[model samples]
Target: MSTSIEELLRFEEERPPDGEAERQGWLRPVLRILAGAVAIVAVALVALRTVGLQVSIPVLAAGALAVLGVRRVTAALSPPPPPAGGGRIGGGEEEGLYNWGARDALNAAVKRWETPLDWSASRPERFASTVLPRLAELADERLRQRHGTTRESDPARARELLGERLTAFLDNPPRRPPSPRDLAVIVAELEKI
Candidate 1:
């Protein structure tokens, strides 16, 4: 089943009540930091006992300072947690149907080709209107860039370079999309031009 863009954007998950997540407060983090600092000081004091009390005391102080510095740096670098409310997760503009992600936009464009191809098979005029002009313009541009002349400027030479199939395709787009092999041949001829 096809999914609507609105459905995809809406948050469907169940969330806790507001203020529940924040109620734990800063007490946990402060206690954790203190415990870590004490542990570091204890380890340093034990490790450097043979160096005498003077050196050991200084080492313990340095260890405590290093632990606190690292904790502070990590806290500063990390992003704040999302608010307790069931608000948007990302701290950016809300994405709408038109503001598609890169992959989604590409997929939508690619999928859209099938509709035109189906129309072309039933109505040649539709193909002529939608696809022929673009192809002709591309051919003209390529010819002009390579030979310093457009298809209209030198029709005879352009016809020879573009080949009969592409020339016919541009003159009149097919009722149905060309096969993969035919397309490859057309592309090869266009590259030669």
Candidate 2:
């Protein structure tokens, strides 16, 4: 009984009457401005009185009212909100169909890694500074997922699990980045972890 009552009250907010916004377009912003201005005046007057200051309340009110007016004007210039009936993305049926996943961000991440890797191939120090850290993180993540211990926590066991070549590669900063074939082999080993 209580669940049904709760569900009934959980309905979406009742939208404004159709054509009401068109008929009284200026009413909402005007009311907001009046309310903000009154609030500012009241606060300024009370604060001045409390501090025993004789600052002109009208001046304070005017400044605040101007700021509020600017805000309203800027908001009016900006893009309006989406349409009433749940917009395109908020369909009652399929959820993921309308949603645009972060395709650009995913592409950007690939480029971010690719750029560093490319740079490291020519400049060995770039491997230490940029690429090696990412590789180490991948290794640590795999180790943690498979063995429940990071390299820092169990270095001896981590070396055993990662094997001598891979462990040595990770332990010291390389004088030069590995060839693409070598890097592919290293990646395959990491995946096996």
Candidate 3:
């Protein structure tokens, strides 16, 4: 006897979403602040009791609010991660793409920063200062030896190498700088040599 086709197709359990990770950006911090405030208030209440001051319910509430406010302010001031699926080479695998993969990783890492390389500095400078300099220094000292014996060198090649990928980065080139991820990808590609 054999099972019907429909029965065979039945799944024992539902599958998870395919790596569609919703970056816990705003919401996660908000929740953390809330939790911290509650904890601080609980401590403050105990402290007030020890000091013999009548723990006013309103005062306790205000303390809780203060903690939340402080936390929110901190979170807002902190930086955010790079956009999702920005530098991914393959479907979802972040490894084995070699230089491409490394570039993808570098771009991803740099993006998780607050102040990035000043795009206004020009492509060459941005590359020289951020990506090229570092990779050239790392992989081999003489690869671009004429450019610079050390890591610091012109960023033009990096920018040029980026080509189309630099569209979003160099478009403004001033206020909005290229994220760390962009520089990283460029560096990774350069390093693979």
Candidate 4:
């Protein structure tokens, strides 16, 4: 016999009925209901006495029994309590749903570029020393992967693939690095390879 992939991946949860919980403690509910009814009757009697009306003790006892009966009926009609293990803050993901402290979620490659890019923004030497070599390596890797040759290995085809502007930019590093917009354009062109 063969099982379908959907059937293999499907998850089913089976839980037994919770009728035992209601039967577990009969005394607690009776006492709690009795206490609540007594408190309610005491308050009602106090209110009636303050307003200059006298209610007999037997009438108050009857009223407490009525309250207890109503409470029992309502408890029977109300929904059962929820499953034992829910109502959590997170969506039950790994670790936690929130990062309470100072958490920076940057990709590894992008994070690696941050320091060099920051330094390069102020100084041409920093651009040459820090950021330029990484860009060159990335360009060369893409060229090699797609065309079987790096920029150094085949300058002619590299220049052809890299447009005139990109080729020129790579060949001669500017005294001052290009603006972020121009650098982004260069990176976009490199990605096309």
Better of 2 and 4 by lDDT: 2
How many clashes in each structure? 0, 0, 9, 0
lDDT of 2 by residue, 1-193 (tens): 2567778778698777678776578787678788999898888888889998877877887888898988865665554454578556556326654434423444555687787456446777777777788999999999999999999999999999999989999997568889879889999999999
Q: lDDT per model, in order?
A: 0.70, 0.80, 0.55, 0.77
Candidates in order, TM-scores: namely 0.36, 0.40, 0.26, 0.40
Which clashing pairs does model 1 show? none
Model 4 residue 150 CA deviation (Å) reads 1.2
Q: Which stretches of candidate 4 lie over 4 Å from their true place?
A: 1-117
Residue pairs in candidate 3 whose N, alpha carbon or C atoms collide under 3 angstroms: 103-185, 107-181, 110-180, 111-181, 120-173, 124-155, 124-156, 128-155, 133-151
Q: How would you encode candidate 4's per-residue C-alpha lDDT over 1-193 as one tens digit per residue? A: 9999999999989665477865656867778877887887889899999999999977987888897888776665564443467444554436566333323334344676675557555787888887788888988998888888888899999999888988888889888988988898988988888
**Residue 51 Cα positional deviation in candidate 4, in Å, after optimal superposition:** 58
Model 3 spans > 4 angstroms off:
1-26, 78-193
46-155 per-residue lDDT for model 1 (tens digits): 76675755455665767797869787866655644534662454433445322223234335555787665753346656656766676788899998888787778988
Q: Report the Cα lDDT for residue 40, model 1.
A: 78
Ranking by TM-score: 2, 4, 1, 3
What is the Cα-based lDDT of residue 61 in candidate 1?
Answer: 66
Q: Per-residue alpha-carbon lDDT of model 3 for 81-119, expressed as tens digits?
A: 444765554543355443332435334545666347544
State the lDDT at 17 in candidate 3: 41
